[model samples]
Target: MPFDEPSQIPRPPRRVAPDDRPVADRLADIRARIDKAATIARRAPAAVTLIAVSKTHPAAAIEPLLTAGQRDFGENRVAEAQEKWPALRERFPDTRLHLIGQLQSNKARDAVALADAIHAVDRSSLVTALSRAMEQEDRRPDCFLQVNIGDEPQKGGCALPDLPALLAEARGADLPVAGLMCLPPAGLEAAPYFALLAKIARDHGLVGLSMGMSDDYETAVTLGATHVRVGSALFGARA
Candidate 1:
């Protein structure tokens, strides 16, 4: 479900109930987990940001979480986000959007226009394109250099050897290089990969680590993940 493969875009799994109460409670539980994980790691809970990945969910399914005081939301497809977020943003002006999916260089302008942060800037071409768009449009979204930490060929990260250069390029372009992101190979022990990403960020003197998803976010928190993207655990199974 990595962002680069659009043909394999994840389909929504199942419909969640219309009731808002569960959504409120669900967020509270997630917040508790985040707090516990942060405490165990001896880091302040407020240091980590939880981004509800509302990829395939419509605005109705998303609003309850917003009402629960979840301000940061993430989306995979720019087009899908375009369809849903404008109305929602009109209603909730403080909502911050993160592009937690792979991005194409061609869509740089739109991505720059829509996202508060882009968590998938892994290549030089994208850095150049995004820099131009941001300059022309007067928008500079925070950028994360997605690393193929597991060295998976199909993933959208800049390979390990290329990360430093890419980071340097992103900085050179004046794109706000905020952090490093990765998708450790699914079903494997994720801690090592998460640890590796944190180390890379440290080696590069970067402050953010956008690792973890629904399954292993707590483990990631232990290893210093600044942002964890959760969808199913907060919203229920996709339809």
Candidate 2:
């Protein structure tokens, strides 16, 4: 059950059946779930920040959750977030935006301007781009070095073998690395991946672990996820 060995990590307990209810009710449920998981892990619930992934959903769709007091949110694309969040942030000035998708080097400036945290800092070129952007913008968004936990080819994360070098490069450039992020391969038990990610973060003395989505957030919480990117569970199925 040691975190370093993903295969030895036990499968997460089966979650209850989905709750089909209003947004506020679902939001409450997810929070309660996080609290329970954190308690079970002997961690404080406040340690987990729930990031409602607002990608693809329109601003109108996001407002209700904002009204319901969900402060942190994640978006995939810089342009979409640029178009959707400015007015929303104007109203809810405390809202923290997280860029949870792959970021292009070309969009580094925009991402630095918009996101409170940039979760997919994978490559050396991107680290340089973001560092330069941060200097120009006078903003240092928390950067999470994404580790391809499953080593999947199509994923947008630094391979496990490459992480130490990438982490060094990012720190050498002074990219305020908050922690690590990852997406466990879909349709499999997620605990092992979460555990693996937790191990990596601990190995590097990083405190932030931004893993978990709607389906497996509780497991992520129990495994020490500081930030959980939840979308469908909060907003319902996307079109």
Candidate 3:
């Protein structure tokens, strides 16, 4: 039997599902909060870049946000990013991927390939590893030197006093030291830490500053953060 001609082919009507709470509603709520935060900081809303941290959340959860026009997403673990990036890239090619976790030297190549920016380059060895990896891959991802502004030994960042020298070395290596990144101590106000980071970046002529997470992003913006990493607030608590 001959198949039906193109003009005679039958088509099924598209089915549209309804939800009590639209995705835009959630995004509106988030945008409102971000607006309030920006206003409180006296910062132009456009100055603060919100990076939707999507670590541990499945791609399905993120698909809605992507559909809602959120283009920046951050992940903490290299292994998780390595696993998630390929599929997410296929699905959302325009989405920007950021590595906001401590990066080990061994994972440098994969991180360079998958991340649009690495927000956690803490030490010279890691930078060297990244430089070598980028050379091998013939790629260079934007990088932020994580600074231990709180001076917390437990944190994975370079000490504050060590920053200038590190920045010089990173620049010398021909790596793009995009800016500074930091994690303030728990229960501590983030403004001072953010201010300090901004000053350091200015002194070195670096422009990018990746600071603040969900808890202290407003404070960070007030202190001149160009980028803020927000996770749980954007995507419900991650297990």
lDDT of each: 0.88, 0.91, 0.80
- For model 2, residues 1-239, the per-residue Cα lDDT tens digits are 12243563445554435567878998998999999999999999999999999999999989989999999999999999999999999999999999999999999999999999999999999999999999999999999999888778989899888898999899999999999999988656898889888888889889999999888899899999999999888887676
RMSD (Å) of each candidate, 1 decimal: 6.1, 2.8, 16.8
Better of 2 and 3 by TM-score: 2
- C-alpha lDDT (0 to 100) for residue 73 of candidate 1: 97
TM-score, predicted candidate 2 vs. hidden true structure: 0.93
Worst 10 residues of 2 by lDDT: 1-10
Candidate with better TM-score, 1 vs 3: 1
Question: How does candidate 1 score on lDDT?
Answer: 0.88
Q: Estimate each model's TM-score.
A: 0.91, 0.93, 0.86
What is residue 8's positional error in candidate 1, in angstroms? Answer: 25
Candidate 2 overall Cα lDDT vs. reference? 0.91
Q: How would you order the candidates by lDDT, starting with the best?
A: 2, 1, 3
- Residue pairs with colliding backbones in model 3 are none
* Candidate 1: regions farther than 4 A off: 1-21
Stretches > 4 Å off in candidate 2:
1-5, 8-20
